[model samples]
Target: MAVTIEILIIILLIILNGLFSMAEFALVSARRIRLQQMLDRGEKGADIALSLSEDPNTFLSTIQIGITLVGILAGAFGGAAIAKELEGTFTVIPEIAPYAGIISLFVVVLIITYFTLVFGEIIPKRIGLVYPEQIAVKAAGSIVIISRIFGPINKMASLTTDAVLWLFNSHAPQDPVVTEEDITSLLEEGTQAGVFNEAEQELVQSAFKFGDREVTTLMAPRPDVVFLDLEDSFEENKEKILTSGHTRYPVCRGGLDSVIGVVSVRDLWSQMTAGEKPDLTLLIQEALVIPEHITALRLLELFRTATTPLAVIMDEYGSVAGIITLHDLLEAIVGDLSTVDEPDEEPGIIEREDGSWFIDGMLPAEELRLLLELEILPGENEGVYRTAAGFVMSELGKIPIPGDHFVLNGIRFEVADMDKRRIDKIIVSKIRHRGDENPDEKTDNHTTS
Candidate 1:
């Protein structure tokens, strides 16, 4: 009965060690935001868990004390009492009696260590990771009690740790900082867990990156911007109005380089409806002027503070670069929004049946990076370029002929079509592995746009 009591005491010690291990891992691994949320919801013990986590020195000292004391007591008591009992059993055999003391002590230590390693460490740590927040909260009160019981010892240990750090001129440990990547990771988790849909996730991500995008990337390029030329005949202006089917037009005096203001079809119609002539100059509204290099986010702020949403983008040389509207900025965040009475526009990217992709030269580099699963595009940091055409040009460092092709990170990019000096369209084959068949070379059969 006395031997049975000793064995039970060893078992109890192992269990206590396991609790210490569990509490340590749970508190360390639990997300502070999650613990705070639990506290906000009035969950018991969450506050203590959060508090303990904030003071790593105290919490670690408390957990180490429990684990160390349990280990020592279990080892000493278990090795002595169990080995003595086992030695008696072995001595019954005459041949084993001589080495029984040594053999029994070894066997007793081995059994105790195995149980301690599994029950007191690995298994508990795994369980703690599986439900860190809950386990941390549940274990917090007991840990606090233990910490208070041995407060002086833990305080001494922490003081010693601080003195050693002071010798090195180091600062105390700081709380982990939450960054944009952390929020993005949580958003991805929320997406997988069905709390957010893919589109919703993309919108949030786009909004986060909106401040980094340049105005030139979002504007309608000079060649694409239709205008109401004041010098043109009435029939010519009417043809521009009918053919473009757009709501707003920049009223230029001479050419695209010289812009006066913006005229809206709605403002023209309102004049005609009021029994007045649809005078172009009379209908022209003052448009906001912004530098082409401005970020889309700052432009948004400008729009918010301005009377009109239409803005004329000017390049460094004081030439008209492009035009932008509030709708364009909205599209950058939420994706393309087709205007009423217009057919659905073709997407910037289309994958062919042959596994090659037809990519528009005007496609944004950010979109290209995601499509290619690339870590980054060239000139991403310094804002050297914006579109895929700009990316291709920066890579080649010269004008590219229609047949020009190159490989990057195992993906083949070929200039499929060109419009004079500009890149009009590109054909991109999917990524190839090192050992896969060599990417087939293509002859340029496409026309010059």
Candidate 2:
């Protein structure tokens, strides 16, 4: 009967140790955000879980003390009581009687250790991990009460631990959390594992890259931008507006540099339908001016708050560099919109039959780099110049004429066509050589024909 009581006590101590271990693991692993959400939904005990999570050190210390005390008591009382009980059982054999006490003690210790390791530690920890929120909430109140009862001892232990850590120039281990890179890597792995489709993966990756893109990278270049000259007559402006088919046009007094405001074609259409001539001054709306170096993500916010669809990008000298629309800003996130109606219109890159590429000069350098599969372009000043034309001009240090060609980094760039002084089209072809490709290789070959 005494042996039975001792075994029951030992089992109870093991259960108590398991409870403390479960509480410690569950509370530490529970997500605070998840707890808050549960609280918002009026889930019972979520608030208690949150309270315990907030002051983790004290509650964790309480659990540690409980586990330690339970373990020590179980070891001492279990071994002694079981040994006393087994000593009587071992008296049946006279030969075994000599070593029976030691053998009984060993057997008792083994049984206690096995139960403590499996039931007290592994099973409880596994349960806590699998159902952290549920277990954490259940264990929170009990742990908090225990912590309060041993508040002084917990404080002393914490202070002593801190002092010892400070003396050794060490700190407590922080909770392991996922980082941005880890999330990105997980997203990539998910894509490979069929968890995320291609379009979904692209959207997520685009979102991550959205903030890194500057306004200049997405804006229509100055050469491609269609604007109205304030000095022009109503008929001239009306003709340009009809031919261009653009809804919004920048009103520049003198040239592209002297942009005053933006004018909407809707306002012009209203005036024309009202029997009044389309007036540039009256149709113009306030233009939202943003620095060229601003990010596309920030531009989206500015557009949202300003309630403007059109914004003029200005350089450091306050000159109009280019223009960006709401559609342009969104393209950074969703990628290029399909132009199904305009099939004849040339894309940024046109592949030829001879494995060469005819690229638009205004195509973004980053896009061109991807198409060409080149690590670095000739002259890619990340902020200053973002387009292919700008990159070419930067490399040559002058406006390139038609038929001017140069080779750099195993790729050959030839001016296919030029619109006045501006580069309009370029021919990109890969140069395959046995040895190192010469960067100074220049040719007057216009490869378009």
Quote each prediction's TM-score.
0.82, 0.70
Which residue window of length 10 is worst by lDDT in model 2?
440-449
Name the candidate that leads on TM-score. Answer: 1
- Per-residue alpha-carbon lDDT of model 1 for 337-435, expressed as tens digits? 988834476789999998888999988888888898988876876788888988887776778988786766667788888988889898888656555
lDDT of 2 by residue, 76-157 (tens): 7866877877887887789898888888888888888899899999999999998999898888888878888989999998
Off by over 4 Å in 1: 42-45, 86-111, 141-176, 341-343, 407-410, 430-449
Under the 3 Å rule for N, CA and C atoms, how many clashes does model 1 have? Answer: 0
lDDT of candidate 2 at residue 157, scale 0 to 100: 84
lDDT of each: 0.85, 0.81
List candidate 2 segments past 4 Å from native: 80-107, 168-213, 231-245, 266-282, 305-308, 339-449
How many pairs in model 2 have backbone atoms within 3 A of each other, for residues 3 or more apart or on separate chains, i.e. clashes? 0
Best by lDDT: 1
The residue pairs found clashing in candidate 2 are none
